[model samples]
Target: MNQSQQPDAADPKRRDILRWTVGLSAGLVLAPLAGCDGGSDDSFSATVDTLPEAPRIVAKNGLIDIDLEAAYAHNSVQLAASAQNAYPGESTQQATDLRSYNGAMLAPTLQLNAGDTLRVLLHNKLPGNDTKYSSLPYLNYQNSTNLHFHGLHVNPGIIRPGVYGDYVVDTPDAGVVPGASRQHEIHLPADHTNGVYWYHPHLHGSTTTQVANGMFGAILVNTPRNDFDLPDDVRDRVIFVHRLNLSDGGRSDNLYDYVNNKNSAFMLNGVYQPTIVMRPGEIQNWHFLNSDVFYPFNPVLDEHTLWQYARDGNSFDRVFRPVNAATSVQMDGRHWPGNVLYPGNRSSVLVQASQTPGTYYLRAAKAPSSTGEEIVARIVVEGRPVEAALPSPHRLPLYNAHQPITDAELAQHGGKTRAVILAMLNKDSDLLVQPIPAGEEWFIPPGDGVSLTDTVFATGNVGTKLAPFQSDLAVTQTIALNAVEEWTLYNLNGYPHPFHIHVNDCYVVKVNGEDIEPYWADTIPLAPNGTSDQPTSITFRSRFTDFTGKFVWHCHALDHEDLGMMELVEVRT
Candidate 1:
């Protein structure tokens, strides 16, 4: 029951139903109806049948088993910089054991047809690192991890539930936590969409550690049965983007320090040392995913339009949809056409063949700004047309416009909220001369300038030790906000820290609580530590209902969190 499958060209009635399904009822009507057919050759299908045939890779519908074995040493292999693996000369670091993979970790590009069953066997070899000592949400440290089939319409609770220590909504003995040597089955609905989906560890606390060890992969779905309606000229390629932050030692035996302080330096798949190269005049569709901590990878297209095909493996039929959180987006309305892939997420982008064949560079954009980084891949579109390329259904949906928040919405909430500052605690420096008495909430007075950075509150004691419940602000320990209070986060650090809260999908109420031109995110990217502002900030609103847990609010950067950058958030409902 693949949701992205189109109606049969021979059956007009089913075709109309599918059109309506892909348009208005993406989740409900389209999903269930597609599932009822049970991968049958019936009218209710989840693929397009009118296009050319897809190149065969694995079986149309089968399982791809991946295992993580512990390695005490390092492995070396030559990586391919070209599509056909012609120039495999560079020797790079490899995962010594099942527990790790590093220095350009590779995963097979999964290609499946609609109604295909994706059964995966994820084995965890390095045990006993669950939650007690690990920083990530522990599914089961003894043999914990998750297999979240990102963007697929399936039950997450049941798929690849690794061993459970914490961060699991489903308890063990319920089949959510896998015992040692046990394998879990993830069932994808027949009507699931044909876009770029992905798999990774979803164990709450331990996600950082597991993913850092190269425990992530990409999932690509072909149209109904992988044999239907695929264009000849363009072939789908799955590119898994990962950040390798390994220590000086070998990869396999190295401990996964979720709190690694260094920023990500390597891009595993297409942007690694040996960049991906493609033939000219041959259209290539790229499916990308960023398995980094929380940094957003924005790729650039200079000569090409970078036509988007899908997000999160699901096809977007209509011109508009709402993106309220960090999720997958399929640009093409179908599986054949590719789309744009965002950082910390997945996307399908199609690079059409160029009339003039030459080397074209694809670069990665830095987070929280428009600036891009080094080339990720090079397209030498010189070869003849491979096959009949399927036309990407590039309908500029209005929903895409609403994505990443708009300027007007940011302006409306700007200046309507109060500013809050983020700074580290050290003994001695108190420009405000405000002492943090024990057992009280802290509060720093907003300076007279439009931005918080302009206002100086604390200074000098970079060597001071912060007593418990003692902060630079006057309020001390508790951060109390009156009902309906709008707050703006004025990040004083120089490095990027993604700010996140529990329960509520926060709108970018304002940029620095004032109208400004900048990107908006649920996780505000703070400046790097030790750098002076150029202050960055964001505002958000909350109703404060039904979510009265001892939740946490902090920078999504795992290193920052371990260094006491996180705080307890108790929203009084």
Candidate 2:
């Protein structure tokens, strides 16, 4: 049943039951956590709707050191709501029914500086993967996993001896099989922007299957900034939106219908409807991550304005001091209403408490067709007021926000524009029955009298055709270093598909042929259009700069990528 159609809204008896299942029962979830001993611990207790902070790992002495294990653990905070997506009568997840990092449902938030080295001992403790599904073009190594720093400009290969970088396109250097250990050494560039990003397993074939079951965390990048950067413990809030796709028996293997289901319940830090308390006139740093496999979140703070500094971990030039005598700096970088965040995306913004002493809500709508908004978090602004100034990009010690690619930069590369298509197999557009395209997953039959033949999307490396992704596949795209190119992504699928690229952020030039103000983004949602002739297109300009080797761009819908919607690329001097 749809969440809006659930009986809890009208039936007071059901509402009482849901409240018990979702709110106070969360206390049972906080018992077994070991490393989550960080953050504030203030709550009303009787009705435990208060927002709980996730366990965190902080960088010390220029390095973030920790051990992260991937295994089946007992996370009591049931991600699925009883009436919305959970199994009937199941309030808490069954033992060993889910997988997570360090046996905790709330993945540890990694707090680090821009130039720090992250050394992690990743242990894979899951049992052997079912090799029956491991085949070419479409593989699901359900028990194997690896790490991908989603939006940081780090090296795509090894960082040092006995350590791996942000590379996940290769198998031997990437995935850690059961009973295996991999030392991950991710080195962020000295100029890496201070914003929000995330870490997740990016092993091919099993990427979506694992992520859909809850296996992701926030990567909060920080830098030295005066008067703006807030403390990590007191006020920084990480809202990770992910689903616990469960079977009827509460196992995490139920993949079908959950991603496409509009009424799926999204958990906030593994809990539902947690309260976020703030004082009047006080501003707190809030970062959001959409870790869901398929849906889009349009986040809105009721009657409050959000100062948006970055999107997808790329800082914007929008936050600045007034050029003219505009005292309020109105609407410059503020999301007065809300913004649409796609899956595998992290948004960094600042939210000030309402001046009025009252109750408000942090709500989100799953796409546009939902019956109404779901209250994700309750913001209680009824404490002593404190005056806090909004941050400006001009005051930061080292602020290198996005500088849009101009006409000159595009002309250097001869204004080359490339086009790629995203679509479903002609036989099936939905995964209700099973995962499609047992083999030849790259085949897209001629639609509307056209396909990616020799004339279009035909790069020399892959040779005049599109190919599904394999770790050892040849680089399909060889981009000239420092050259800026424009790419148009077309979505011919019936549902929305988020396009994401690693290593570099892009300038969003246009959406569906409308010219918008250019902004920096690492991910974008191609509008849905089922027809190939009139597909939805998004135009973005990317400048391959600094460091590069081998990386990938794919559908961030995850399952679509896992099922062969990814392409490999290389940047060379």
Candidate 3:
């Protein structure tokens, strides 16, 4: 099975994935609205002592109304003090007389037991803007946006984009686009399976900007399968990781450029401070997400050990495979035994309470940039079991390999393992600039081995005048793994794009032909340069089972997806 060939960005496997995604989703359109313009970035005191009060809820006509002005602030997490940046989605503006540190709107943590009618009413009072004054990214709106329920089976009719429902709230037509004046409604069945799900803005073009500005939250689909009885020290806690750009100026100073293409700081769950304290007898579920505007966060726990529970939205059984070394794995769509949580396209880690109480860090795992901070969250396990002591420093044998499923493992699921690969591509021309608008397409040089449409590469040029444009394709590989199928991923680009898949969890089996450890994950950060010390390809394999739905595969970097490195996949019977 010598399937190895020189990495070509124009492979058939990549094209099929892109075609399927476009066919499944409609184009996004911006709705017209006039409201708040922008704001300044004046610095204020940290408010870790005072957590922003929960949002005031008002139910009107099957809609849950929320005050956009209300948000949460961590007084303890300081800029350059407790952390490098403020929280990822926290807001800085205040509409009331009470002044404190800038805060963030609490993205609702939908704790549903399935079969629940979920009505969300988001009021548009808070305006959208980069710290720096620049043209608005995505839909050019006057500070208004909506929500997109990732990985959940909800009707689009009720999930309108832009302003709160004005019409009878109808599912958008296939051609309808997300606008500034949109609203959305979602309903989930009780049997939807327990896992980690997430929500954010899906309004094309600006999804990256809106999400970067602060529009994301976690959704926990609880089920009875969460029955792992471990040591009391490993309680599950939900941790959210997001990045923000801030400048050295004052309040609403447009300090850091996020949407308009500048880079800045990263935060966890909207805060950075002392280690999160929790009882030793509880399970900590870290609901992680990489909401970085242009970067993928590789979280690593420096002084901690995490017993990963789930990935994407699926669960796994114990003792499914063996590991050998320390390998960096993408947390695309892997799961633990009970589907505790889904990290979305982002990665998450479930740290079982170790019997020994100590301090630990949840940092980015082998990230590429030195300019960004690696420590996203810190953990302090307080209660230790009487008989337990610190175990020797031993890594899980989950590196340099793809997750393997034996007959014993599949037997638990009645012979079902469903898998689907998603393809993402940067599909527009005019790099370093905007597209030529609708009905206009960029022409690529023929026989130049360059892709002009349906992809988002840096530029279509392959380092040659004949290849003057970088590959605009965002993603390029998608495959479906049956119970006995093996999946392989090839990095066909000059730059590193974080590859993520939804539905089932997989392990990296090999990187550039060398067998690594068999660790599990849902998002894999393919390194850039595609040169030595780094392989040009990574192969992964997994037995997909226990779930079915329309999920997406994309670069963990939100900006890449918004620019086009994103696509959807459906697991079916």
Clash counts for the predictions, in order = 89, 0, 131
RMSD of each: 13.1, 10.9, 15.4
Write one digit per residue (lDDT tens) for candidate 3, span 240-349.
55545543331212211333323434555555433454334334445455555555455555434554444554444343221111333432222111211112353334
Alpha-carbon lDDT, every model: 0.40, 0.62, 0.39
Q: Which residue pairs does candidate 2 place in steric collision?
A: none
- Residue 24, model 3: lDDT of 8
- What lDDT would candidate 3 get against the real structure? 0.39
Tens digit per residue, CA lDDT, model 2, 1-573: 222122211133422222212111111111111111222532212222356566545555556767788888765554435223211223454443677787777776666666777777889998886554322323546777888989888888776776888878666224788899888888888677777788888887778767876788777666312124443222556778765666555565422323333334666877666666666877777678889887666666777777666677766564631211122222112211126777877676677878897778676654532224466667777545677777666543334535778889799766877877666644433321133234333332343132321111111121133334642332367788777889887766656677899998888887777777667789877766545567777789987888768888888887677656777888888
Q: Candidate 2: lDDT over CA atoms?
A: 0.62
Model 2 vs. true fold: TM: 0.77
For candidate 3, the TM-score is 0.54
Least accurate stretch of 10 residues (summed lDDT) in model 3? 21-30
Q: What is the full ranking by TM-score, best candidate first?
A: 2, 3, 1
Which stretches of model 1 miss by more than 4 angstroms? 1-95, 98-123, 129-199, 202-206, 219-233, 247-249, 252-265, 270-282, 294-298, 308-348, 365-373, 385-490, 499-509, 514-535, 540-554, 561-573
